[model samples]
Target: MSDFLQTRVGAALKDAALAAVITLLLASIMVGLRTKTEQGGLVIVGQWGLVAWMVGVVFVGRLAMSLLIWRGNNPVANAMNAMLPKQDTVSKIGKLVGPLLLLFAVTLPFYGNRYVIDMGILVLTYIMLGWGLNIVVGLAGLLDLGYVAFYAVGAYSYALFAQYFDLSFWVCLPLAGILAAFWGMILGFPVLRLRGDYLAIVTLAFGEIIRVVLLNWYEFTGGPDGISRIPRPSFFGLEFTRKNGFADFFGLDYSSMHRIIFLFYLILILALITNFVTMRLRKLPIGRAWEALREDEIACRSLGINTTNTKLTAFALGAMFGGFAGAFFATRQGFISPESFTFMESAIILAIVVLGGLGSQLGVVIASLVMIGGFEVFRDLEDLRMLVFGLLMVGIMIWKPRGIVSSRAPSVFLKEKKSVSGDLVAEGEG
Candidate 1:
């Protein structure tokens, strides 16, 4: 091997060792030693096997990743890459996948069991939030780490209104969205001049502020205990109860599955609406402005585009959809809590947007399914799930930061019909 290749392998080995050491420390502290109650007495037990397994996985994963990186440009790999499909072909395949996934989602409840349906609901909720954040972070180039605050706002809005005013879910749904949008604009005002890490800090602080308020103001937000027994959504004034309910109205036997199915369809419709609106907006002038702002705010301003309005609109509309999803979440769970709206929620949503491919709607759907659905599959490995996922995320950030869907179709094309590959436009410049 060449000296360069030897150096690469050496660096890879060193990095893998470092990663293994770090994993050993974390796993040992978190899982190696644990407390078990024996006869009403707390006993410290050692689970060294689990810690060893974690370290082994980390070392192997990091070493393999390093080797892959080093081999990426080899002649054999180049030949294999050449044999792969072209960008246009891949884009066509992505388009086909979107419709198929939508069809599957629409028909899922019929074939899926309760657990499957519940996971579907959770996945769809993330998809909706991903699409919403896509408007700001993906299109407008704003870094919003506090996007979940709007989600909490929408949930609490519905919960409070339903509890105090006896409002229907339908009524509170729009109100919740509007309230969340209002808060989105409120967040927008403070960080108008901020960009990059500064922008992220402000947004993160905004989210924490919202959470702190919800946590401390026990009289209004119910504090950490949260608000429970919130009303469930009925179909056009039809309850899901035993008598005069959905089944009785239709002369069918009542089943709790009815509500689950309703929520499934309800969220599906809302997500579709969000998708349609975003697609349409992309064709409008404002949508193009968002793309311009994302590309280079200074140039966008030089072109006489009002940056202030563009940013505010992106924030407000994004927050609106988040609120919509939040309202649905609240009604579906019949509870609202500060714990549900944390910084981690924002990170996960942003991760979906980043991993899926910024500004690619289909990418968001694909990534949400992989990340969210995959998380469920690894539910048994709760101890190592986050560690493994964090490592995977780190690997992606280093190797494939452009995301799974590295190519995206342009919103606007010339009369000559030019093509724009997403790689031509690097994301996160803002």
Candidate 2:
């Protein structure tokens, strides 16, 4: 027992020291950049302060992770296990929470502050995007670092057609999704045989290619100036204008809240549709094929599954949902640029999917809320925001390294269904 204690303490200190050194190196350059003053003056300052703060944060984080998370017989895990409900109880809780959340969302427009509603829209957009990417990454085991390419395609498809052809928002919505799916298939074709880091590089290149095209295609995509004044979606044929809109039709006072509310529901419905389709797909043969391929491509082929079509479908479907969210983003913002659909956007969506517990719908929603909503909450902190965000992410990874929903509810069962803990599942075991 004495030797074990000594070993644990020594390991924790070593981890903390390594963390401090690495944080010092990375944050020194990252958080130390020059900044513009309010008076338009430039200052190459704040390096030492940033480095000091980062080092302390990383040291403490690493220590805590080693002591509380990775340590054998951790009390934190013990306490959580004691408190955690059984599978049946969790299902009961979910049934109750789902309806209540939907109810709150439905009435939020009437009672929620504008800022709150806006955050809701942002969260839901990422939720949809995360769900879309979940198909490729979680189900099909594709590490696409450039999923934002489809998002850009969808946004640009909607914007260009709406501007030049004068199409209504409704008319262009599905078209945008289809176009994005087509691009997904096109991109998927070249990288079908690749996997892991090589596949990631290819996908990243694809994303950058799309962004560059949008950047340099000045004649078509407006180049760096971006597309602006993109029209918002109307209620059926009724525009949401103050004079003759939903409010006017319903004889209610017209507030801009109505517009925001519409967009909220629009994304909500779209997200729900994405969730529903994904859930339904999970029960189908192709869906099983996805999981099979994700686990072992060679085994999947041995079982007579066509790996190529499965990957393409996953990519296409994932891209389609991303396109849907992108179209909604364009309509909501009334403007979009290549900047809006950067690689960082893809990273965030991928993060949400992974952090939410790959292949879990409810996990994606919770992750979006925590991540996007947490960012909004910490927006005023500025310099400290990323620090807090990184800590939270690392903490969660340590606490539940697989994700919040690390237990997989099996899609098939012989006698009764059982929740399979991620700890028991090997890599690609799903």
Candidate 3:
């Protein structure tokens, strides 16, 4: 009995087998069949082969992970980590990565095809949204499940203002952000006393309320059909028209690619601004209060910090950036719809913040790229797409539960600033 209990391989095998069986039971029905429209009708084609494939992948991944965690028997893992570069060297490389990635993004429009550029725009938009949500969920330890409300508010605000007031995109941009922030404050006020799951539920309800209002307010919001042909932003008062467009003004031949490139740059700039402000805010007294609030609310109050203002500012600032991203989305798409701002959008943004590392700006970027760009990469997987994605997410959580960038540099420090592992920080669930 002692020998059996001591066998790590036996334990790993048992655990992996149990996990595989559970996964098979839960996911088999959905993954093992496919619906295809035939001349006769919809056909339920058997995809048992893919089902087996998915289950096998999960089994192998779980086995590997279990072996790695076999009661302190993973010397390979410890040695590998020990062999990695020192923290200081890694920090230098991390600094270079941001600049190098930025350079690549800036140059992509010039060399990449249209599809790549479009994906870049989409990725940057999510990056911006993730950073915005980081303020509330990451820094302030507020769990907001319905952040898309602010995003919808921003998009519709710009669309309505432009349509009724005849305002250009430039004029509507800040106004949209302001309106969204106003709504954020409104949300903040009601949920002030709430925390944890209660706060999340209320925030989720707020998002649904906005969505329902947009769906039903047919006269004002255009209902499910959505408002279309939103005025696109011009290049500094110069339209994208072929006659006096940006290309013509610059003495270059006109091409539709100009608009795509412009949108890419616009979103990139917005993302950078969001990143910059978030970084600066991390050092401010208000920001420190946010972190304090995140770490321990009771302690924060005891330390003379205004918890109400801290939470309100977190919500408002986060919503403001979300509004900015939403405005860019509306202009880039030339349309606005409630469907585009669904709970799934909020979930994805939150996932980025969590999967990256709460309150880590660079982590948000890496997670956004992996999640958003990787979505396009796996589009071809079809029925197995989600199954594959689920497996990857499970693996990530097992290996790096705290996130990829698990260390956080303190925003304020009495001595030299030292990197703190994210494991020490609160998960920011509330």
Candidate 4:
């Protein structure tokens, strides 16, 4: 036992020593470079900031090595390293956390300022869009680059219907969803046999076609001028406009802030619904069929799963959600234009899904927050903002090629306890 302990400790110390030496060499090179590259006629060592940074790096490296060597022999440290929360406990915590998050989202606007509320709404909107795309790309393994086309369809559908028929937002909303779903099925048909890059290219082309059509079709779509003065959502025959609505009804001074808050909660509710529905679907037989098809389409067919129906359903459902988001966007902005639905929009949506783990809801939320929220936050930086954002994305991919979140599928089956490794047990016995 003493021999084994000594061997492990010695090996750890050797590795740590090697790592420290490499680190020290790198630090020295950096210091040398800094010394050679004079700034403001000052030497490298003369720069207090640079010297302090280099010294701190060396000190930290040595400290880390010492800690590793010390901990190598400690039983308590070994046990702490091996410790992990039980699966049941993790699941319970997730169950609790999800609802609490939803509640926070719902009520955030009531307490937050107008700017914060607006940002929250934007985040939730993207979160919904990300989750919707997740269903097609993540669960169904369908690469849809033309998703923004469906969004455009929904927005335009609402705009046209409202303009021509004088319909309410509530009516236009579902109509837009249905129209988008129809378009989704149409897009899905030709790409049924396609996979990977080919599917991506085809979808890309489809999205471009939609945008081109909207650009050229002036009479119906209003072309470059776009549609404006589109109606905002109304509640119980009361319009949200400042002139005559809730503000006066409640005897409070009217402001756009209230409308912003209302929209925030409206989208929050929509996002929650989207999340709930997708989660429920994943547990159902149809959802399982999608997952199996994603894993292996041929095998899914061999198992008697209807590949055509599964594919269509995934496309339709994803498009429907995109449509819902589009309609909301149209109403929220009170405008529609060809520029709103572009290839860039599709790319950003895809990035959200990919950067988030493919099938993770929480990951989608985080990714949307980071991507969309970060973009908005960095808007003031202009060109530099995009450069930095691109670099940040590159860094994240290099660090986590799979995704920021690794686990995609929810663990449906009961987790069995893992047995100790036979080799480890044998070593212990010896």
Give each model a TM-score. Answer: 0.84, 0.83, 0.86, 0.76
Candidate 1 lDDT by residue in tens digits, 254-359: 8989999999999999999999999999889999898888888889889999999999999999999999999999999987789999999999999999998888
* Model 4 lDDT, residue 81, Cα: 53
What ordering of candidates by TM-score runs from best to worst? 3, 1, 2, 4
lDDT score for residue 40 of model 2: 65
- lDDT per prediction? 0.89, 0.87, 0.89, 0.79
Clashes of 3: 1
Task: Name the weakest run of 10 consecutive residues (lDDT summed) in model 2.
Answer: 421-430
lDDT (10s digit) by residue, model 3, range 187-291:
899797898999999999999999999999999999898889899999999899889778889998999999999999999998999989989999999998888
Clashing pairs in 3: 143-430
Q: Clashes in each model (backbone N, CA, C under 3 Å)?
A: 0, 0, 1, 0
> Please, what are the lDDT tens digits per residue for candidate 2 over residues 1-430?
6575478787798779988998888887888665757666776776688779889988999999888876659888687677878878977786687678778777877888999999999999998999999999888888889999999998899999999999988889999999999999999898878878889889999999999999999999999999999998899887887897888899998888888889999999999999999999988898888877877889888888888899999999999998988889999999998889788988999899899888888788889999999999989999999999899999999878988776766777899887777776433422
Residue 225's lDDT within candidate 1 is 90
Candidate 2 collision pairs:
none
Scored by Cα lDDT, where does model 3 land? 0.89
Q: Candidate 1: where are CA atoms >4 Å away?
A: 1-84, 416-418, 426-430
| Candidates arranged by lDDT, highest first | 1, 3, 2, 4
